[model samples]
Target: MANMDISLKEMMAIDGAIGAAVVDYNSGMSLGVLGGSKDLDLQIAGAGNTEVVKAKLRTMDSLGLKDAIEDILITLSGQYHIIRPITGRGGKGLFLYLALDRGRANLAMARHHLRAIEDKLEI
Candidate 1:
């Protein structure tokens, strides 16, 4: 299994990746992070994304949706932000947040890679 640091590093290797982080939504804290541009702060992104995850989950609950979220994807003109919650055998309240360049990223492949990473990640 990959450790936190190694997992973040692997995330950065994804094509067009701008930044990545392993965050604890319950506490709004980042466990590990890698890469960022002058205008992008990973810490801020991590915390902000926590709210996004919570909001969606809350909405689902209110709607009585029975489906579980695999991930949340936000597409911008130039970037794509992906939020994937860790559902390891016993993992709770953790997620992987990734930002990539839309022009260079393959959303399908990136999602697949993130799933692989999540499956092997050690909390």
Candidate 2:
């Protein structure tokens, strides 16, 4: 099984990966981060995305749907942001955030790869 460091490294190996982080949505903090530049601060992004996750969960509750979020995809002009919540027992309240260059990223493959990494991650 992989740990946070290994998971973050694997994430960066993705074709268009710009940055990656393991964040705790409950506290809006990053447990681990990698590959971010000054222009793309993973810490700030992680905190901000915590609100996004909370809002979605609130929406789901209001809709009376007992469902879990698979992931949230935000497509910008030049980038694609993926926020995938960790569903493993030991990973509750945490998520994996990835930023990819839209021009270089294959969205399907990135998602697939993230899922694989999640499966092997040991928190």
Candidate 3:
């Protein structure tokens, strides 16, 4: 399995990937981060997205839906943000976050790449 560094590097190789992070939603902290610019501080984004994940989980619980979340997509005028909760044993309570330039990204391909990365990520 790929280590966190390798996983983050692989994520950056995705087309239009602007930033990527492995975050602990339990603590709202990033375990690893890469590719973020001044315009997109990944640390802040990781923490903010933790709330997004938590809120969604709460909503799912309230609705009594037993299904697990595969991912959450947030689209903006210029970007697409993907939050994928890590379900692996070593990665419980964490997630992979990616930000992409909407015009340059292929959403389907990006999602596929993220799934592959998630499968191989060691932590």
lDDT of 2 by residue, 1-123 (tens): 999999999999999999999999999999999999888999999999999999999999999989999999999999999999999869999999999999999999999999999999998
- lDDT order, best first, reads 2, 3, 1
lDDT of 3: 0.96
User: Per-residue lDDT for 6-97 in model 3, tens only?
Assistant: 99999999999999999999999999999999999999999999999999999999999999999999999999999999988798999999
Candidate 2 lDDT at 22 equals: 99
All candidates' lDDT scores?
0.93, 0.97, 0.96
Instruction: Name every residue pair that clashes in candidate 1.
Output: none
RMSD of each: 0.9, 0.5, 0.6
lDDT by residue (tens digit), candidate 1, 79-113: 99999999996458999999999999999999999
Rank by TM-score, descending?
Answer: 2, 3, 1
Question: Cα deviation of 75 in candidate 1 (Å)?
Answer: 0.6
For all predicted structures, in order, the TM-scores are: 0.96, 0.98, 0.98
